[model samples]
Structure formats: C-alpha cells, structure tokens
Target: MTADLTVVHARTLTLDDALPEVEAVLVGGGRVLMAGSREAVRGAAPGARVLDHRDVLLTPGLSEAHIHLVTYGFSLSQVGLHGARSVSEVQARVAHRVLNTPAGTWIRGGGFLLSELGLGEYPSAALLDEVSPHHPVMLYSRDLHMAWVNSAALRAAGVHEGTPDPEGGRVVRPLGCLLENASALVARAIPAPTEAEFLTAARAGAQDLAERGYVSAHTMAFEAPDAPRALQRLAQQGELPLRVWACLPHERLGQAQALGLARTPGGLFQWGGVKFFADGALGSRTAWLHAPGFADGSGTGIPLDPPELIREVGRAAIELGLTPVTHAIGDRANTEVLDAYDALRPQAQARGIRLRIEHAQHLRAEDVPRFRGLTASVQPIHLQADGPMIRSLMPHLESLSYAFRSLRDAGAVLAFGSDAPVAPPEYRANFAAAVTRVDDAGERLAPGEALTELDVLRAHTRGPALAAGWDDEGIIRPGARAAFTLWDRLGGNAQALVF
Candidate 1:
C-alpha cells in the first residue's frame, strides 16, 4: 500500500550511532521512511509535504522512565507543598486549603521533606490539628512512603498512640504520622475516586507529560487498579497523548494470570512488568539499610518485600512473560534485590526479558557491577533534594548515592524519570540535577558521578526505550517511530512533535 508522506526538516539528532545526525527526515505511515539531507529525503519521497523547522533541534521523543500517571494527574489539583521550608509554612498552606474546602471533606497534599522543614524530629499531629481541626488531613512526605495526618484523620483511621505498628510499616508515637504500610491504614479511609475521576486524572497526567516533551511513560503501578483501567480507556478512545508502559502490583499477578493476560503491546498502552517494593524510601526513614544506618540512629531502614518473596513472586512473574521490576533504594535493599535477581537472571535471559531494579538509588561499590545487564530505572531529579539528606543522614554512603556514572560504566541501562507527584516530571529539573550533581545545600554529592548533557538526554530517551523494549521509538532512523521532540537546545525549552 502507498504511504502518506511528509518531510520534517530540522537540526536533527538521530541518536542512531550509525547515522548520528541528519538535516531532514521523511516520515510516512507513522514511521521514518528516510533520514538524510533535505534534498535526499525530498527525492526519496516525491510529492511529500515539507514541514521545515530549521531553527529547532529535533531529537527522538523523550520518555519518563518512572511515574505514577493517574496519581500525578490528581496531584495537579491537590495541595502542593514541595518547597515548604518550615512547619508554619506547611500549616499555612493547609489553612488556606481548609478555608477554601468544605468542613467534612478530607484535605490531601504532599511534597515536603522532613529535613527541609527544619524539624530535627518528626512533627506531631498537633501542628496540623492547630491549622485544621474539623477536616481530616493527610500530608504525605516528599517520598510518599510516609504520611503526616491530623487528629481528625488519625481518629478516622483508628490509629492512636497505643496502636501496634503493622508489620513492614510504622505508626509513629503521638499519632500524627504513619510510615510504610502504616500509611495505608489511613489511606484506605480516604474515599476512592470514581471511574470518571480516574479517567480525568489519567488524561490530565498523560497530557501533562506530553506537554513537557515526553512522548511516553512507564507508569509504575503503585496506584489503584482503576488507574490503568482509565489509561486503557483513553488508549481505546484514541485520546491518550503519550504512550504508556504500565505495570501491575505483584499482588495482582494471580488475577492477571487467571485473566490470561500477557505482554500485549500495541496502540498507546501496554502492560509489561510486575512491580515490587523491596524497601521503603529515604525521606520516610524506612529505606532498608545495612549497618550503622541513619546518622540519627534510626536503625537500618525497614525492609518491605523479603528477598525470599521477591525471588518467589519475581520468578512467577517472569514465567508469565513479565519483567520483574523491584524498587530498591537503600544499600541493603539493593544488595538483597541483587541477590534475588542473581537466581532469576538465567530465566530472564533465556526468555529475552530484562530484569529491572527501580531506584537502585544507593548501592555498595561491589553491587554496582551486578547491574551490568539490568535496567537501573532511576530518578535523577530526586538528587536536587536528597543531596543534603545523603550527606547528613547517610554520609558514609554519600559517594554511592545516585551513582549514575558508575552504573553506566558498568553497562547498566540508565532510565531517567521524575517519580512525579513525588517530584514534578520536569525534564529540565532532571537535566540540571543529573548534570550538576549539586543539592539544595549548594554542595555537590559525588561530582565524579555527574553525567554530560547528552548522557542525561540518552537516559531520558534511549534508556526508557530499552526498558520498554521499543527499538523503534528513541531514535530518528529509517523505519523508526515518527515521534520527535523539538528543543531550542538540548535540555532546554522543548515540545513534542509526534506525527
């Protein structure tokens, strides 16, 4: 069949090692027909429409390697407290939201780091109670692994001072916050959004990523099942702006297998991985660690999924044609996950499935090499905030935190993302964080691990492509996908230009 053709002319970075740069590309049938000089492409596609963008820099479309899609959409409308520097500041924000919101409605917001709040210790419920007495309120830490709630919210979730901490989580003293699984106790009390709400959130999130120059995202499965359902609906309706590679929580493995679900890829959405959390996050003080844990003597971070469980369930996931994606943040967590992956590696390789470790954030020097063939799905944007914490809390391991260069040199595929809502899915922030290796304290953390602008861009584009097993999407080459991101300069002002 004859193809409808168009010629796109720009200062193009093909990202194809074979043909690294091009002046023009001929696109047809949603794929690249040829990429070379304008005259050559024009001759290759006679009668093709010419869309010149000579002043712009065109590269393969960007991808968000990790994010919670629908959740980020909802966060767009929720109270934002990412930069709150003091307890009074947080209270002020909640007070403002309270004045605008109704009395009985639950108020939700997050994005504050404990270290940034100038509180040597965790804030108590009284702080939020003073600002919001009538409405139940839950404010998540920047990491999302912990939640600070008011008295009303604590009562609603039946979490009191005497309540025993659930296994794999904690209920802090004086009843103001919940950690790890304990956060779920209160979260379960929050009303679930309707299908329509989910759809709206899904649309909002996907469009937000597209607007930020991301052509695709790997929506990590920490959200409700309705989240993926909403995205699927959008894809079915042809309204999804960014392609999504989503995962199911390991808890849903049985249900998925019963439903005969497999690695089905097409349209704008696909399910390719089964997600597991090996430990909690840093800001939450629950990141499972080895000896001499947090400098504050908080003990080694909490471990979530046991190594035994990961091996068992991870194998089951691979047997069913899914990638085993585990979140390992702390050094001990990475060690345990690497041990688990060791046994599963043979199975993964035989089946052509890539084993993935999300965050792989803090690692022991020896464990770095274990990631040689694995995908290190990381968020460099976290470094902008975590740099100070790493110095103050885990100084002994500072050099190994966010070890981008080490992982890359060892052959691990570096997939970059923002872990959005936890942080904004802003590519510029990512570029700055990865390239500068500087933190909020104006100090560099492992400057030796800093990446070049091109390296960061590749992680945003090619790395995600490798993770999603999409050889066609991250390069501008003959037979590649016709999606492109135009930038005024690399890592600068950008927009998606997908055909």
Candidate 2:
C-alpha cells in the first residue's frame, strides 16, 4: 500500500487526550491519517517513507491568536525604541537612521514607551530635532496611541499649534505628541510602501512566524488596508507559509461591504474579523480608566472608538459572518465593550461567531463574567514590560491584569498571541511569562493568575483554533491538520511541521 507520509519513532504529545502521550502519527493528503503505537503505524503503511525522530516531542502546531504581521515585518527594518532607556537613546537611533537615509525621506519608526524612557512627561520634539533637524521623523510610543513627531515631520504633515485635535483623538499641547486619529496626520505624510514592499513584508512576517513554530496566525487589522492585501497576494502566490485569519479595520467596513468582503473559511488566508479599538493602551497612558484612575494620578485615560459605533458595526460584522474583535486595554474600555457586546449577544450567537476582545488586559472583577462566551485574545509576553506600569498605574486592578486563569475560570475562551511589532511573537517567552508570571523587574505580577504549562499550550493551540473557527486544527487526531509542533518539552524549544 502506498502511504503519503510517515512520522515514526516519536513520542507524540496529543493535546486532544488527557493521557499526555502517544507513540507516533501518520500523515496523508495534508491531514493526520492516524496516531497510535509506532508498530501499528508501520503495519498499516509498510511502504511509507518513515522519518524517525524518537528524541523529540511532537504536539499540534502553535498559533498566534493575535498579531499585526506586516507591521511586525516592517519593525524588523525600522528603528526600534523598545528598550531605549532615555530620550537621548531614542533620538540617537533616529539620528542614525536619518544620517543613513536620503534627504527629504520621512523616517518612520516606533516602539518606545515614556515609562521605559524614564520620562515623567512626554518627550519634546526638540530632543528629536537635535538628532535630525532636516529629516522628518516620527517615533511612536510602544502602545501606538501616541506619536512624537520632530518639527520637520510636523511641518510636512501640516500640523500646527492651531490645528484643533480631531474627533476621537488628542494632540498634546506642546505639539510633540499626536494621539489616536491625530497620529494619522504625520503618518499620512510618510511614503506608502510599494506593492513589492508590502509583499516582502508579508512574506518575511509569515516566514518569521513559521520559523518560530507558528503554523497559523490571527492577524489583527490595526494596520493599513494595503497590508492585508499584501498578505492575500502572498497567499495567492503560495509564498505564505502560515495560515492567516485576517481582519478589516472598522473604519474600512463600509468599503469592505461595498467590495463584498465577507468571511472566507477553508482558505490559506481569509478575512474573518472586524477590528475596533475601544481605547488606547496602558503603557501609553491612554488606556481609558474608571472613576478611580491610575494610582499614580495620570487621570482616567483617553477613550478612542465609541461603544455605540462598535454596536452598529459589530452588528454589521456579524450579519456579514465576520467576528467582531475590539482592543480594550483598561477596565473602563473593557466594560464599555462588554456592554456593547451584551447588546449584540443574540445576534452574535445567531451568526455562530465568537466576539473577541484583544488584549482584554485589565478588568474590573464585576466585569469578569461578561466575557463568558468570548475569546480573550491576549499577549502574556507584554506583561513583562507592562507589569511595573500596570502596578503603578492601576495598582488596584493589577490582580486582574492578564488574568488568564481567572478568565478561564470565568468561562472565557483564552487565545494566546504576541501582538508582535508591539512585542515579538516568541512562544518561548510567552510560555515562560504566562506560566511563571515574572516581569522585567523580576517581580511576579498577579502570580495567582498564572496559567499552567498545559493551560498555556492549550490557549496557544486549541483555543486560537476555536476562535478562528478551525475545528480540524490544534490537535493530534484523525481528521485534524498534519500541522504539528516538535517541542523539547511543553514550554521549551520547538519547531513546526505543516505538511
């Protein structure tokens, strides 16, 4: 008998069963043919080419449940301010980029945090100007809610001191920071990438995720419309190595509807969700809060997208068969989103779509159960950097921040991700952080909310698959995809094989 493929002499860690071990697995037609004792497999497919890896542990392929693939790809080439300890360090990097670039070109980079830069206040444009007075420069805070544009960039964008802040955004008084929609002012002035650039970014991002053992990713659309189109191009050209569940930003819903975009299952890449933001992020000091704001007195943070718009668009998303996923980082943001979701519950259920809240990061105890039937697509790795800020800013709610265990107990489906570009999608880092709850400061933030290794694996695998509506993935069993991750251990070294 001719057999398609055989993986023998390996201990399979099938997440489907509670036994914690299986002998081997057989693959055919890009699906799991069988999984059982190695001897049983050899007897069934005697002619198959057997690749033995007895030393390795095999489980289902890991998935990043949330990420911005193209942005992450571009970040690989941009100035990264993620670890810059001071404003001088950020300016130095920007200066270096400016020196190397041609005149009149806009320097685009991001991933700095005022907290990390050790600045009690937003850095002034003067700091960046000292480094690159002639070149237009825009540096985004790590959370992405705010941007610091050098004077040249501000001039290029036509933003002046008298330019009133746009609705749903704020322009810091000193003209150094543009929040939410206002950041688009400077961003619009920057050059849009060519189609080739987009394709390169998509391919690089997909390859990078696959190299890290991610067989699939749920790419949130907090990016330009061209980004997802680039991913689609890659998929069509067969250059995409990872399965992608893409999204359309809420602002483009009207265009998507006009173009007849809807959920497309059973494809290498598909538009499956509508993305919205209820507020900004904690690290950026813009995460919308409740009455008792940040303990450090930054005041209740800024709210971005209104809940009413979420309800209207969310309904449209459900009617069109796309899941609705919102970015809600603070307690108030989460609460407002939940209220909007509750208003759409019946419709969401009727459409067979699971509502998702990306970064469902911090929460009020009372709002915990509101996520009962939703997917909390979260990035545990971020806790490493945000832990101290979380403790200082919202100390009272620190226990519920990244509350993986608590969310699971509250009946929320947890889907793990890296939110890369914001942070890299490193599964090992995620495993350690989620399971250990250790932060950059070496302090354990809400240790009581930590998940077990198994829980982490399950969230990273099966949980994301479910959220993506892929029933035939995230497991080692008959009728499942041949995608598998070979791990040194549950949360250790890993590699992926998607046959």
Candidate 3:
C-alpha cells in the first residue's frame, strides 16, 4: 500500500448536497480522490491502505468555530469549576488547589456560574479568604467576563474601595469582584506564562481538539500575542494536529496594517479575520442590553468597543481581506453591531468577506433578520446554563434568545462553537442542547428554535468552513481535504480520520 493513498470504507454522510451519502472514499496526497460505492473506490485504489469501518459513520471533520484555544489549554491544568453548584463548592475547590500550591503563590481558576452558585448577590472576598488566605485566588465566572478574587488578590492588584471602575469595566464594591475590562486589573498582576509554556499550551489545546474529532478551528483573538505565535510555531514545526484559522484583535489592526499584513494563506495556520468586542458576556451581568437590563437590578450592562470604531475599522479589515468578527451577546449589542454592519456590508460583499458575529446570543426580533447574510457563530451548549437566567433576567427577549432556527431560516450561516474555557468543546452537548432545547433547570428554552441533528452537523462543519473561507475543508468532494470524523453513530463517540 502506498504511504499517501488510502481507502476508507464506512457509512459516509457526505455533507455535499450533490452527493448526500456514499459507501466508501478514496484519499491520496491529503485530499479526497473519489467517494462512491466500496467496490468502485476499491477498484480506483487497488494498492491503497484500506481502513474498514463500515460499522461506523463517517462525515466531514468537525470544526470548533469559536474558542480561546490556548487559554483553554492552559485551563486544563488549572482548577476546573464548570459545575460547582454552590458557593461552598467553589470555595472547597479553591482550598483543594491551594493545599498543594505553595504559599503566597497566585492561584488561577474559573468556570462557575453566578446563578449556579446560588448567591443572591455578588460573592464577597471573605468567602474565598475563609478557604485560602495565604495564597491569592481568583476564579473567573464561566463566561470569563468576571473575576472573583479574594481580598489578598485584590490587595496585590491595588484595588480599593475608592478605586474607580476602568473605562469599560467595573470593580464591584465591597471588593470581591471585577467585571469586564476590570478583569485585566487583577490579571496584570499575575505572572505571564513563558514562551515555552505558551508552546506547550498550544500543542495541548490543538491535540485535545484533534482527539475530540475536530479537524479545524477558528480560534478567536482574545488571547495574549504569544498564544497565536505558539500555534503558528506548531504549524511551522508540522506538529499542529488541527487546521487553524485565527483572528487578530482589533486593537492590533494598525500594527498589522503597518506590517503589511493581509490574509496569509496555504499553511494549516492562517490569519483569517479581525476580532472586535461590542459587549461582554451574560453570566457576568455585563451584556449591553436595551432598557431595563438584568431584571436582577444590575443596571444596563457595559458596552466595550464603540460601534463607530467597528464600522470604520471593520471596513479596513475587509479591505485587508480579513473578515470583521465581533462578539455581541446582548440584544442591544447585536442591534448596534447590525447597524454598524449595515454600512460595512457593501464593502464586505464587494470583497467576498462574510462578516462574523460571535455569540449572537440574544437578539431583538428585528436584528435576527439583520444576521441574514452574516455568520452567527453561536454556542448552543450555553443554553443549558442560561435558560433560567433568560427566564428570570431577560424574559422580555426570552423567546428570541439563542434563536438558531430563525437565524438559519433568515440565511445566516449557523456556525456552532464551544467558546471553550467557557464550555468544553463537546459537540455531543451541542447536538443535545440544540436539538433538545433543554437547560440545566430541566426547562425547555424556546423549543421551537431546536435544530435537527443534520442541521447541527452542518453548522459545525460547513458553516465554520464557509466562515473561514475554507472552501475545501468541510465537504467530502473529490477536491476536498481528506479529513473526517468517525462516529460510532452520528453525534455519538467521535474519532478523527485524517489522511
């Protein structure tokens, strides 16, 4: 058998509309050579290495549409708090980590929900101090929008009662929390990872995704400069397991322009988009909603990047052949972003750039239609935790929250993602959350918006491919990349099959 040629026999679900299904596929030189009946494919590749997996289902490889991958990789080694149901549980976890960590060492962890913690008010610094006073501890909310730090951590950061909130963030009073841009206030004090650490994290994250059956990822640009550099280094060394389409933070746009940066293609790692944040996330009560925000009396959430900046710089991004990818979680944020895009859409269309909106989570009914031609990179698994929040906090827009079907029907490319570190990159959870519409509270959230399993698969595969301008990666056509995900059954256990 030739090293570069292989024939895979399986129940193939070729996402290609032209050929919905096939029995086997022939692959050579990292691309699909042919896909047809097993006998026909065998006839075409007589000497190819044959992988007989007729019992499994083969589909186009999965793609993680949105993730702070490097950060997620680092998180794997830190304290995991994804399901700590109460404040005591959070404290216990922190104490456990501190037991082994050195005294006065900074402890970092996250992935807890305010609602899940069962706290009526913001958790106080005293709560954590009771567990780990010797070591400074800071745990991020599940959304990464807020940081819950102990008094020691706060003192180390010089945060005090009189300390004013940062321009786009808040230092919650009584001194236990930092919100939005305020996270950096404490983050600045923590030690930064070395370049080698970044490289290790990059490898760990990429390998984790590949092991989870993803062939590619669109890593959002919310990480440190070294993070992407780490991924780039992996790609250059030929150690990267998944193809990556990365974004540059909007703040770096000027420098990128000066360096004559544009979409650099051909490698497994490519610069594909410019990312912007219109608002923060929901878990932290920082989403920029309309009037009567956060029925819990958290006030109208903070807005970050101005829509004007997004509109002006977004055009420049498109001119540089980069898609303008913005994070808009609240209805108001979406409306403002949609308004900004209304002006930039012409330029985007001219350049064949599809504007991307990450976390098009909550939308005004009118704004849903605005997403018609844009990419709605939403995370459905979030619905599992956010269902009750939507009911209690933003019931006014409950019906339109995470409106997957409406967005898809309106022509918005439905790109599903994990936003890992916020949630794990589990496609099975995505399938269940999207198809079931059931949340942690056992309540259905907008069941009418539920998607079929096939729809979910397309969102995970083709939608991300189109979003990243990866025309040859998401389908199983002759010219498509020979990367696939084998499942015991569709949406079941996954294993990557890359030639």
lDDT of candidates 1 onward, in order:
0.92, 0.88, 0.93
RMSD of every prediction? 1.1, 1.4, 1.1
TM-score of each: 0.99, 0.97, 0.98
Model 1, position 294: C-alpha lDDT score: 96
RMSD of 3: 1.1
Error of 1 at 311 (Å): 1.0
10 residues in a row with least lDDT, candidate 1: 1-10
Q: Best candidate per lDDT, number?
A: 3
Cα lDDT tens digits, model 3, 120-195, are: 7889899999999879898999999999999899889898889888899989888899998988998998988999
Off by over 4 Å in 1: 1-3
Please tell me which model should have the higher TM-score, number 1 or number 2: 1
CA shift at 204, candidate 1, in angstroms?
A: 0.7
Clashing pairs in 1: 288-301
Off by over 4 Å in 3: 1-3
1 or 3, greater by lDDT: 3
